[model samples]
Target: MEFWKNCWNCGHDTPQERVALEFFPRIVEMFSKKEDGKVNQRVWAVFYDSYSFTKCKKCSAPSLFVDEYWTQTTSPEEAKCIAEEVKINGVSKSGNLVHSHIYPGFLKEPFPQWTHDLEETYMVLFWEVYQAAALGLNSLAMMGIRAIIDKFALDKIGDIGGFAKKLNTLLNAKIINADQHALLEVVVDAGNASAHRGYKPDNNHVKICLQIIEQLIGIEKFGDVINEIRQATPKRT
Candidate 1:
């Protein structure tokens, strides 16, 4: 079977193929102690424990992962049935499993290399907010995005009044087009809602907001940075 996983070496999503694998069902017996200081078996949990050696097809980087599956409390008979099934059939593809990297330790989502080209303070804050989003701190991450926009506007066109006013100035100055301006308004308003209105955005929403921010920072400037520059330059009469 093939699985798509983030390649630790290449920092890309790639298909992984299992090279060496072994799995077996094991049962853990839970014990409870009575008032008489006597211990008695209370319940049993059965699961399949396995070590999968997989290699990234794109980069050929090997990763050793320890995995556990089907962990739940069950009766002895049920545990026996599960154990027999696992022992005979091996690991099932359509099941819940936890994969932990044991060899190269842990890995984090890789950020784009171009993000480092941003101005110093914004660049640092951007990465911090990215980490916050990755860590599931949605509210803080949204607020951080809002703060970055505020700072970016300030750097672009002075204090430039409030948030809405800054966006207007950007539009009037032709820094951002109608569509890009509209998208920024949506994200900035959502950021405000997330900050002051107790609105918590989902991961999908955060992802979209991040994508917009990325586009704005890129050379394209969400549309055409070069055209915007031409618009800024005084045309020969």
Candidate 2:
């Protein structure tokens, strides 16, 4: 079969074709039994787990194509079932199974679109924080989060100061209220610790930080627009 996929080795999007191979069998023991007046078949038909080579039409790199087969019924006369591209390996007795390779370039969760509206430096820092969190680098993620606050203040307030001072200025300017200021202070403290004292925040800690930052950015960029939309919307009868 022919298909298109991202080639991890060559780092390109390429077309691929599967190559077929001759099959051989491995011996696995089987047994059967009878209960009451009925005959019960204990052994199912053999499944061939074979690897065929797929060459990338663009990069010419060979990837392993998995072919798996099994019997659908206990009767040997029944036709076999086939799966062309089985991703998961066979399950273990303990119920454990191995999965196929996942493309790292594809994000399972996407970053918010509001990020692009931020100033260039703020956007860069915010995306760095996101990528760090995704890669499980909690300390670096915290540091990036801290840097985002600094960049946000600089872009919005046009001043350079410590994180706490910036937060105070934003509070005085009515950019954030008392409750928001208090929450931001907590994030600032955590970020400072991660940046200066080599503290590694846990997943929950970083998640809270990301949530707060996302909410703040959303409000800052969209608050007036949201109010306008709400006013324009008709009330239900």
Candidate 3:
């Protein structure tokens, strides 16, 4: 079986070919609720959980995957189509992907790879938080964003009181401008809400929060390199 996915090792979406003996319907539990609302009633509702061991065509890295497929959710015609698809292409073309557990897991999209060159802790934490956001763990991702900022502040300028003070200090020292400070304030507050108030942000909201952090991390990591480039440029005078 072959399917497309973003390869963690290659950092790109590529075709993956599962081993010929790779797939199996490992478990099927009573998934749907009965009309009678009884504990042990049988209905037309069933779901399949399957596993696949595949190799990334682009990078040749092996990955193990568990995919949850709700078969009864689709119409009979669609089911027929899926069956035909499986016959023709050797892949299931229908079903909602409730979860994808790809071993040596993957980021949904490529993030700032240059961040790996920064402090090891921040580098590791940033990727973890990024993956959390990708996995729709908005609350956890928000808390992680806050923690990264806090760690960055402490590493740059010690434990200088609270968020407000640290943000101001960064702005004053030109590490971040007024506009960037305002954005950072939003990120921090979102994190606070998620951490302390049990806030679960919508996907769009989480995306904006993550984007702001991406910019902040880019600046934090590449700012010095950028300054060097500016200095080396010939003067117009």
Sort all candidates by lDDT, best to worst: 1, 3, 2
Q: Go through the candidates in order and give the C-alpha RMSD of each one to the true structure.
A: 8.8, 15.5, 6.6
Whole-model lDDT for model 1 versus the true structure? 0.74
> Across residues 1-237, which tens digit of lDDT does each residue of candidate 2 receive?
566655656666677666653332333345565655365665544544445456788877776644334433433332112222222221112211122332334444567788888767777888888888977889899888777777778877977578788999999998888998999899989988987877889999999998988887767778778999999999999
Better of 1 and 3 by TM-score: 3
lDDT of each: 0.74, 0.67, 0.74
The global Cα lDDT (0 to 1) of model 2 is: 0.67
TM-scores of the models, in the given order?
Answer: 0.54, 0.53, 0.59
RMSD of 2: 15.5
| Number of colliding residue pairs in each model | 0, 0, 0
Residue 49 C-alpha lDDT in model 2 = 41
lDDT of 3 by residue, 97-191 (tens): 46567677566467676876878888888888888887888899889989988987887788989899999998998888899899999999989
- Quote the positional error of residue 227 for candidate 3 in Å: 6.0
Off by over 4 Å in 3: 1-47, 52-65, 69-97, 108-113, 172-175, 202-204, 220-237
* RMSD from true fold, candidate 3: 6.6
Instruction: Please give the range of 10 consecutive residues that has the lowest summed lDDT in model 1.
Output: 82-91
Best by TM-score: 3
